[model samples]
Target: MDDQHLHDHRRLGRELGLFDTDPLMGAGLPYWLPDGAVVRHQLEEYVRELECSAGYRHVYSPVLGKRELYEISGHWAHYGDDMFPPMRLGGGGEEVVLRPSLCPHHALIYRSRSHSYRELPLRIAELGGMYRSELSGALGGLTRVRAIQLNDAHIFCTLDQAVEEARAALALIARAYADLGIRASRHRLSLPGDGAKYVADPALWRRATALLREVLDGSGIAYDAVEGEAAFYGPKIDVQIVDPAGREATLSTVQIDFHQPERFDLNYIGPDGAKHRPVMVHRSVVGSVERAVAQLVEQHGGAFPAWLAPVQLAVLPVSEAQERQAHDLAERARARGLRAEVAAEGSLGARIRAARLVPYQVVIGEREADAGLVAVRLRDGRRVDPLPSAELLHRVTARVGARGTELWADA
Candidate 1:
């Protein structure tokens, strides 16, 4: 089969019951099916764990903000075309709009309390929702959506620490991609070209651009420097990925900004007991959960690794005689936090074919059930010697816990 036919996420997603779009939901809005939700939830949890270990403090913020907030952040000036229009109460009351980005709110959070030099580097993270008024023609599947759940974080640190923070963020991104089996097509140093779209401060732009260059060079990662692709306020390092059609899109980013700190007047007390502005570093390990899942769906061709498979295991009974045993095994697997279900409505062969994409399938026949064992079938079509049900579950659980890419760690 051709590459596009084999790896198209839109087709694979629908066939696997991952996600679907409906007319009533509007264009650019797609609903996640149960299986898709499971995948998204797992990815979100993984990101939270990764960020927590790296000293990021997660927070919750409102999705809607006053119009004045975006205006202050310069989003209204530079990004108004892609933002949803403001909604207001009757008779010129308070007007609000869905936030196009989380940076403004995070900036507000930092300014909420005074900080000392010792706390100069404050890493704030959120699995937050934001909206964009995308054009109808630009919408397709989860790749381009109006509502986005972004795994976004912003770091407030001194100028001297910004490069190191950006580097750490890049390393975290690399770790996540390796675990997920996603690859970077390229690393792009996105700068602001001679365009009216960017904030017009030549000195600030030059400084931020130089800092991002330092980050990429220090990491020893080769990258292409592209112009006219930067954020309105600053330059960034964009980790790019290609789709099944060979179209390139950014999957992750690390950006450095001095503009937002000035706009929000964010400051921390220095060693001399004086207020000083802090630099803002924006980064995302996974840009959008929807897009990330889409990439995974194609990258793995809907046969995800053991830990990421929507249905990790299928328990099949040879006949009615072994049905009870199948249920017992499934229950034990679930109790151990595995995604498992008993498939007994059909012949064992038919059930096995149906669960081809599942990472593991265990069959219980009269002989196996009588011996309290299971006939294990790996997804790659390898058969393992019959083993005690308890032992099989133990090995599978350990493999899943470790997020091993191989079907069997020992193998």
Candidate 2:
């Protein structure tokens, strides 16, 4: 990793006032500003659309849960070190821990209802906030934070349906990354080796690892076998991306788990009317929204694409005389579902510079205003001749709605 590139991103995020970390409140915990919250909401909306299209049901769960819950799900033994210490109530009673993952909570919900084979392929998703105790030294910007919102989902499928379900999850992940202008490398099917990191049961590990290889081989997606990266309970296929600075990060992951259901004593009636444990697949297309946003900020140098840009259009009036006109233009753009804003206070040149700093496509001025058109410049240095505001709106709306890169090009 280039230390300078990472440093540059930290500088940009701080300069933009998006987020901050304080040593007093503890490291790894970030406080998001209003502007940062807007970017987060935009990312959530995008993920929600993707999940809905992929047939995943959205649900909400509590951020804190009883101690026994994680204990039952094996997270206490497997993930306890990464979790915050339990909170003790005033009365002598059980303790609670802030949730580190949504799976255990979602699993409880599934077990609440006695499921049949008909609901075998149940996929529950949540854009849930989670907490972990990260080493203070590891915390930096939004990339490594104590509080994180994960695009998480868990799929409960029968043994026969495991491969198909895994493929569908992979497809959803691929489509999401592609749409967001993120390039994912070929999948890496991670298997457990005869190492301390893996489970001791060689037979069970072999079987679970083979299932992943079979699925990848059948799907015809090129993948390399990575040793010693499997989750404690099962094997996983990780979708990784090397960032602009050449640091490889796991962007998404799909794990096929066989042991968790058995450990939790989860069961469903199968087609043969026999009680069977459904296999669990834990997957996330975009690992963490905070991390993804950080990557995007560096990837595009904070000049986000129209669909993801916090402020899509920055309206600038040439002089005080055109201020009202600028405000009017901003309202019009907002009315058409674009995120448009007028410069609060500054010279025309200063306002344009400030606007450009936050990633916007068009900067309108008096010449185009007098001509009944809007002046537009793209991030890539392309200049477009002024066109009528309504026409410009149509073009922009189409591009934003379609999530097209050409809009950036055409501008």
Candidate 3:
């Protein structure tokens, strides 16, 4: 990696006070600091808004499930090696396990109620937690972890609707990537290879793989078809991203699953008032919140986009005389929904250096405060001409609200 892209997220994460893992907390279980929580909360809110606008209903499911649940979903048979051992509640009591994926619970949710053809493309979304029994060697920063909060969703639809639903999911992922300043390295069609790791039904595998290929082709997305990369349940189109070290990892995916519906006996009423099976389309905009944030930390080199930055605006006072003005500016920013704080303890140069990564810095000096004006410093090191505090605040609020990639709206 070149010096320009040499910043590692683990290093930046610690320096920026974003997240940390401790021996007491165990590896792969990092806790978010206050600043990190703010960034994560904003990212999650953006996803929820996007999903809700696209006709997806948010849902909440338990992190733990009965052992029979995974067995029915075939995770116990096909993916047990990666799953934690089941927990027996008490002496000779029923066993439960931390869910390895949200798909099984979602399948059960779909089976809970009878649906009609009008509701064929029922989209259910969740920012839910799942666990993986990752080997100690594989565990690192947020990129690889045992506990993951996935941005998962499933669409229950007729076979004919599966391709379109998957395509729409790909579109959503692209839109999210653009907003987050993430670039896709490539798209991959992940299929089953010669092995017993997948479901036994060859016909189902062929059909599902064809559907995903159609989705990619129809969306005008060129993809590399790779075998042995598909999930145990079905085939998928994976969106890959390159890290600073030039390694590829999946950032998002759209999968077509036919096995789970059959295993769970999921059904809906057809237009003719007869029972029919609905295909399950599994997709994630950003695979895992922690991993996504880690990628962002590296991508931006700890200076995130305005709306996603932990502290959008830092108010700096030149001296004690302007301290009150600086705080007032911060309050105004907070009122407009931008994360802002005052830095009044250190010298003006020291405070500015400390807040260099902040998206915007408002420097209040005695002259500027007396004239009701403030000098704005952007993340890119550009200092704007003095402008009225209200005007600067207005432009900043507009830029942040729009989530524009530029540091300043005018720029």
The best candidate in terms of lDDT: 1
lDDT of 1 by residue, 1-411 (tens): 898877889888998999999999899899999999889988999899999999999999999999999999999999999999999968978899999999999999999999998986899999999999999999888899999999999999999999999999999999999888898999999989786789999999999989999999999999999988999999999999998889899999999999999999989999999999999999999999989999999988888878888999899999999998899999999999999999988667789899999999999999998888899999999999999999999999998888757788553
How does residue 395 of candidate 2 score in lDDT? 79
Give the number of the best model, judged by TM-score: 1
Q: How close is candidate 3 to the true structure, as a TM-score?
A: 0.97
Ranking by TM-score: 1, 3, 2
lDDT of each: 0.93, 0.79, 0.91
TM-scores of all predicted structures: 0.98, 0.91, 0.97
Those runs of model 1 whose alpha carbons end farther than 4 Å from true positions after fitting are none
- Clashing residue pairs in candidate 2, if any? 28-146
Decide which is better by lDDT, 1 or 2.
Answer: 1
Error of 1 at 218 (Å): 1.2
Worst 10 residues of 2 by lDDT: 402-411
From the highest lDDT down, the ranking of the candidates is 1, 3, 2
Candidate 1, residue 142: Cα displacement in angstroms equals 0.3
The CA root-mean-square deviation of candidate 2, after full C-alpha superposition on the true structure, stands at: 2.6
Error of 1 at 41 (Å): 0.7
